[model samples]
Target: MAGIGFELRKYLNDDSFTGTLKAYGFAGLISAGPWVLSIVGVMLIGIVALTQPVVGEADGSGVRQFTTSVTWLMGASLVLTGLLQLVFTRFVADRLYEMQDTIVNANLFGAMALTTAVSAAIGLILALTLFSQSFAYEFLMLANFVTLGNIWIVVIFVAGLKRFKLILYAFALGYGATIVLSILLLPFGLSGLLAGLLIGHALLLFLMVGVVLPEYPVTLTVRFDFLQRRLIFPSLIAIGFFYNLGIWIDKILFWLNPGTSEAMIGPLRTSLIYDLPIFLAYLSIIPGMAVFLLRIETDFAEAYDGFFEAVRGNATLQEIELLGNHMVSAVREGLFQIVRVQGATILILYLLGPTIIGWLGISEQYVHLYYINLVGVGAQVLMLAVLNVLFYLDKLRDALLLTSTMLLSNASLTWLTLQLGPQYYGYGFGLSMTLTAFLGIILLSREMDNIEFKTFMRSRPAQEVAA
Candidate 1:
């Protein structure tokens, strides 16, 4: 992504209105397009399903079953894959840096294969034992879950390599087919819809596989090098798991709490009051994501590279320190830019909360939660930027601490809020992110302030003999 930003800078250099749009447009596509398009695609499917009415639904009165199933699939898959996603990402980075590019694709295949088996086993257990649905529904659900897990792995692989154009086209075809096949299959009932989802994502999986295949044609042999103890960072695994768990723990509590949720299917449940606002608030992060991509990748990345390069090249302390200051300034400016953009977005949403809720006809009661969660996820972008910088600097301990704090805080506070009352419904998750961001910013500031010592006095390179 940092590399791709240079190409985006080319458009911004045009310095025209159209050029500016092109730059941000490309950035947004790279940052927000996948999830945004996915959400929209699901909404489209729901709207179309509305036309014919939900057929074969157990309740026959609500449309929660299909959506709930989809939700569970997404939530479970993300958390499950979270363990390896960051670890694998780091492996790829190290391999690329070492110019061992041949093994990258083979390792991805290995990872995908492992992910598929794990997700399938989990899905089968849930489908067979816990969830009581028809055989077709269960099978399709399990298949979708496995396919979606593979998709996440491939997506991270491609997106990390900064294949922006391929990402755009791939998502376009994939989701386009999904929507079309879903609509076409809608008439066949929920089973048909599930089949559509399965086929569409399967198409997407194949497309992504095809895209990366040529890049590493050395061997597709199943290699578990990533799992080797020496190369794997347990802290990274913990960080990934904790970060994703923190994000979803609030919603999970909401869905499972006896008072807040109602059983939907088998043990699965839904929190009508808590679900809408947060998902919608995620869409609001587009502007902040765009800004994050542009600033962190372009401005901050250049400064970061310069500082490191100066260090390795034996530059004067003054020159190295100057570049360090530039890097610090870049991170500060980037974070401040996100705050400005996302802040403005939140303010606008807060003001129009009522109007938007009224427009959606979901009840004006959601307006409060909407406003709170907007700020919450807004803070998420800020926290994520901080984490990215820490990861780049190899401050894994600090990164793990922050993410662990996030998980603990969000889980405890959200549960506490639930116990308090509906009035405090969204306060917990929102506040947790704000608190994490606040702490992360402080940590980053301290690191930047100590840049000189960290570079010169801290741990020396492995091959260097300390004085």
Candidate 2:
């Protein structure tokens, strides 16, 4: 991500206002494109399903079912892929650091094949047992889940490389095809919608594979050495799982709670009070994400590399200290930039809340919820920046603890809010993230202060003796 940020920053080298805006604008789009596209695609499907009677009433039953399936598929696939994402990223990073490119592709294939098989088995069982829908619906749902899972695995690899443009193009094509196909097959009802999504996702997976294939030798023999490596950090697996869980835990609580949710399809449920506002609020974070990538990846990353290079080159202790301080300052500046940009963005969206909600034809009640959730997601972006720095600092324990707290707090607080009623709905998410960000800031500051001591302590015994 930092590499991509640096690459994009090159476009803004002229330093003109227009150039800066264009660079950041493009970065924001690419950074948030997949999420924004998914939301738009789902909303479009809902709109079309409402207008055309697709095996359900105009009251949005069919739309609800289609959207519900999509939501579930996304949640499930993300959870399934979460563990693999961090673990595989670590493996790939290590392999690349060692310049062993051939194994990277082979292991990726192995991981994909493993994830696909697991997703298919689980999806098939769930579709068969839980759904009781027609064979077409079941098959399409299964296919969609499997394809989405594979797409996520491919994304892990693609994101590790500098293929942001290819990724953007793939999602654009895939979602565009989905919209067109869903309309063409509208008469076929929910099954048609699912089919469209499945086909689109499959195309996306194929394109991602195409981009990644050129990076390594083609090998039929699959290996799981990365997964099997004895030295792999167990905390990484936990952090991956907990972080993804934290993000979705509140939604899950809402969906399952009787007071806030209703069944949309099969056993799946949607929270009327929580979903739309949160979704809309998330869209507001594009600016923050763009700034995050730009600052952290470009300025902070350069400082970080310089510090390490200085250390490796046997620079004077004072020089190393100065470089370290520079890196810390860069991180602080980057974080501040994120907050400033995102705060302004939140304010703008809050001011425009009514106009935007009115244009969407949603009830005015949603505006307040939208305002609250905007702050929540903004805080989430801040937390993400903190976590990125923690990772760079090799503070995996801190990252794990932060994510764990977020997961527990989000789940418990969201449940409490549900009991407290509608007025408190979005507060749970917002408050939890706000508290987590506060803690992260403090921890990050302290960690940066003692970074040199920590580095020395973590070095080899021989190096310690020499020192």
Candidate 3:
């Protein structure tokens, strides 16, 4: 027993065996930290303030309504962020790849400031127009909250920064402060929660700007070459727009159609409450996003090294074969690792699902939603891995095309599922996406094979791989 226990402890602690665990832990802290606190605040503050004893609704109508609204808002936010990311990520990646100091200082910082201003303005307008009249205070608070959230988008550009460790620590501190602040303020009610969120993000924005912008000052003289490079801007915008639409179609439908009240947990019911399950699924993304970002630097380092090695010299047939094999293996391993981590997480969540939700004061219906979201997450992860590899190979056009196709498929499938019914749509969306992703993988794999052959035949000066 002692020997077995010792072996189990070693397996648990080994870094390679537990890399995903550590990665997930880091991701969860940064990504889900704020949202988790928000949920807790909702339970303690919002539920308690509703001033009614919990009872199941007469019909299942309210659930759909709540689901729709939450999904729509979430989906819209997703689309907005995705579009912003598409433009910014590509631009930063290009400038950083060339080690261009002027572009980093001027173009990057300028773009970020411009983007934040535009996003904040839009959020402010939405808050004023939709919310100002009735819920004046809440609306203003929401506006501030969203403005802060949009500003946080700037943090993504840190992807290109050389000093990731310091940047990550900064984010950790920002998130930690946000969590503590949100919790401390929850006692004052929803307004307090909203105010805490506003302050927290405001602080984060300041922290990021202080850490990042001074490192790369914008140049006054604009390079025509740099301006022309903005040709990729359209691709970025399209990518964001479509991806956002695809993610939020179902959510919008639910929001548009809030139905009658239904049981949320055993006997506890609420009208159209969608936030809980969505929040749970969001927990996965918080960690996933963190892992993806953390790995981005390492991936680039490793990918570029391998890429130059394969292209540097006239590849012997053996070298060609090895490269091809490596490409396939890399894709498989990256995806497999994500799957293993996600599966373990799902299992842990499953075993403790009821107890955990109960403790959080979340409704029982969320249990099934949690499972459905996991399935969606798995499909999304696999698709994301495949896309990254495509980008690595510089098949930008093909990658763009695949992403476009997936976006269309996601939107159409999700919309169609809503017509079938609400409870069915979430799961249906996942199933459809899983199918679509499988098709995408097949197409991308073929494209990769073709690209590899053509690159092997071309005679270009190959870059050397670092040890």
Measured with C-alpha atoms, the lDDT of residue 257 in candidate 1 is 98
Off by over 4 Å in 1: 1-3, 54-62, 460-467
Q: lDDT of candidate 1 vs native?
A: 0.85
Give the best candidate by lDDT. 1
Off by over 4 Å in 2: 1-7, 229-231, 460-467
lDDT of 1 by residue, 1-467 (tens): 44586678898999999998888888888788887888887777777776675553444433566777788878888889889898898888877777788888889989999999999988888777788878888889889999989988888788776686687678778888988998888777888888888888898889988888887656858788899887787988999899989999999999999998888867889887888888999999888988988998678978988998898898999998889889999999999999998999899988988888888777676678988999999999999999989887888889999999999999999999999998899999999999999999988888888697787767745412111
C-alpha local distance difference test of each model: 0.85, 0.84, 0.54
- How high is each candidate's TM-score? 0.95, 0.94, 0.72
lDDT by residue (tens digit), candidate 2, 1-467: 55576567777896898888888898888778888888898788778778886645757788888888898889888987888778777777777767788787888888988888999999888876788778898888888888898888888688768577788889988998888888888899888888888888888889899999887887877888777756366888899889888999998998998888898888899987688889999999899988887888667878888888887798998998898889989999999999999999999999999998889777786577788899999999999999988887768889999999899999888889889988788889999999899889998998988666666667543311110
**Candidate 3, superposed: residue stretches over 4 Å from native:** 1-78, 134-146, 149-152, 162-168, 179-189, 217-230, 260-273, 284-304, 313-317, 351-367, 456-467
Question: lDDT of candidate 3?
Answer: 0.54
Which 10-residue window of candidate 2 scores lowest in summed lDDT? 458-467
Question: How many clashes in each candidate?
Answer: 0, 0, 17
Q: What is the RMSD of candidate 3?
A: 7.7
Candidate 3 lands at a TM-score of: 0.72
